[model samples]
Target: MDRAVQRTDHDAIASKLSAVKRGYYEDEYLELFCPRFEPRLPLINIGTWCRVRAIDQAITEFLEKNTEGKTQVISLGAGSDTRPFHLLPKHPNLVYYEIDFPTQVRKKAAIVRRHLSQKVELCDSATPVTLEGDINTSRYHLLGQDLRQLSLPDLDESVPTLIISECCLCYLAPESSHLVLEYFASRVAHLSIVLYEPIGLDDEFGRVMAENLMMRGLCLPTFQKFSTLDSQTSRLRELGLTHTISAKDMEQYYNDLPSAEQKRIHRLEFLDEVEEMNLLLRHYCVVFAGK
Candidate 1:
């Protein structure tokens, strides 16, 4: 909740504007979770927002191009993300699945029941069970599974599948990350994988960033392993995916975006720290691969 507020208030990320209202108890918890800094660092928030926008755009384009068939979207480590509700109205054929830790899935199911009961259906719950751990609805499904031991339910190979892993893969060891990627790649015949994760940890800023995350007891084991566009694309190809594409950082992505949209977001915030923002963006990337 606090992180969502940071994106909306400080970085001017408009997609997160509805986060507080849709997220139960998020408004009250924001006071405790909000950062103390007066002028928050916009780099992280910008990177996050850019990543979301990029992924959203990719999904939109995919849906646009493949309009005839039913599409399935699986969000790995999808924690309290309201994208399923947001997307269901426009794309009725889209089936959304969110996978996360058991506790996180339970909390999200409870919140959705309380706030969005009319729009969503809870699985096996008489009155939308909140305390329960797993969720299975017509349009949305939530599973409790550790990424290291990820075992997805049987899905149709004929239907095009989109697997999203936003800031989730970096937490796993390199071997584990490959295992998850290969698992999905081998099963899903028509599959597209979109990944957002931090890279470029060999430099000074990257080294410092790694140290900070380590201090917080969070390690990015794959950052240094697949740190560049070439490495990222190569890794996917090695895992049996084809037609891979990657953005080195948000700067490249922003440049590829519509000029009007770029102008609009640039006007939202006064950014004086260009060098720092560039360095920060350069350390993160978005990689897309399909088969």
Candidate 2:
């Protein structure tokens, strides 16, 4: 398989696996071979996990408020996300479109099928509901076209649409990310994006943590430019999304974990260096937007 295809495949598989098994470490796919046996920092994990939970809650709320029986959801780079099936119990008639590169989409569909089958067969009371339509489409329904030259049609102007980018945005060049956002806002009646990423802490500890991760041969983020909360808020203002959710709760969560969990978390270089940066080392976010 092509390298890009392989990565996407991994993305879909890893994401779903993480969500399904509550106790599994998120970086296990990478750390399985090289385990972090040392005590880890609980605060670090708490901070990161909190952001993810917040995104899930925000999307869930959006679905409950807007979905009457016919709303559509487009999860960009929808790696192994089970939100579609999970949400089905709440709103069985809504349609979900998980879009990604072909290989990822194929693998995710297979996973979903296998998971549903096991659920039905193993659990006496389990009831499975099918997601509507063919899984693959050359022209996706929302954009239904290549993103490079995206220009969404106005035919479905009245439909309530929610676009989720998640952690996928930071990987794209900022310009490309911005263009995609612009396209969605223009086309969708309502839109929400959840971004989780590393930002510059500028403190000595923050810098050291990031560098130490690189030294340890972990995935180093290619894009490292981070803006202050004010700057980030301004950008969203330009895009007409004004709601904000700060990730500061994550730091607290990590710090509050029991001693054993804290050890696993503190082992990571980033967590150890957080305090050295004048408390600037942290996770931050903005979730509010208007159509």
TM-score, each model?
0.83, 0.62
lDDT of 2 by residue, 58-167 (tens): 67767777756466667765655545555544564455666655555555455444454344221123333345322422212212233445454433556666667655
lDDT of residue 29 for candidate 2: 32
For candidate 2, the lDDT comes to 0.48
lDDT of each: 0.68, 0.48
Residue 99 in model 1: lDDT: 82
Candidate 1: tens digits of C-alpha lDDT, residues 1-291: 222311222222222332333221122322222233233345544555677777887778667766897999988877656667677667878888888777666666666665665653333344344446676666667787777788766666678888898777777789998998888888888888888778888889989998987765667778879887678778887877777745457678866878886676676566678788778878778888777
Q: In candidate 1, where is summed lDDT lowest over 10 consecutive residues?
A: 24-33
For candidate 2, the 10 contiguous residues with the lowest summed lDDT are 136-145
Highest lDDT against the true fold, candidate = 1
Local error of candidate 1 at 266, Å?
A: 2.2
Point out where model 1 deviates above 4 Å.
Answer: 1-39, 120-131
Report the C-alpha displacement of residue 85, candidate 1, in angstroms: 1.2
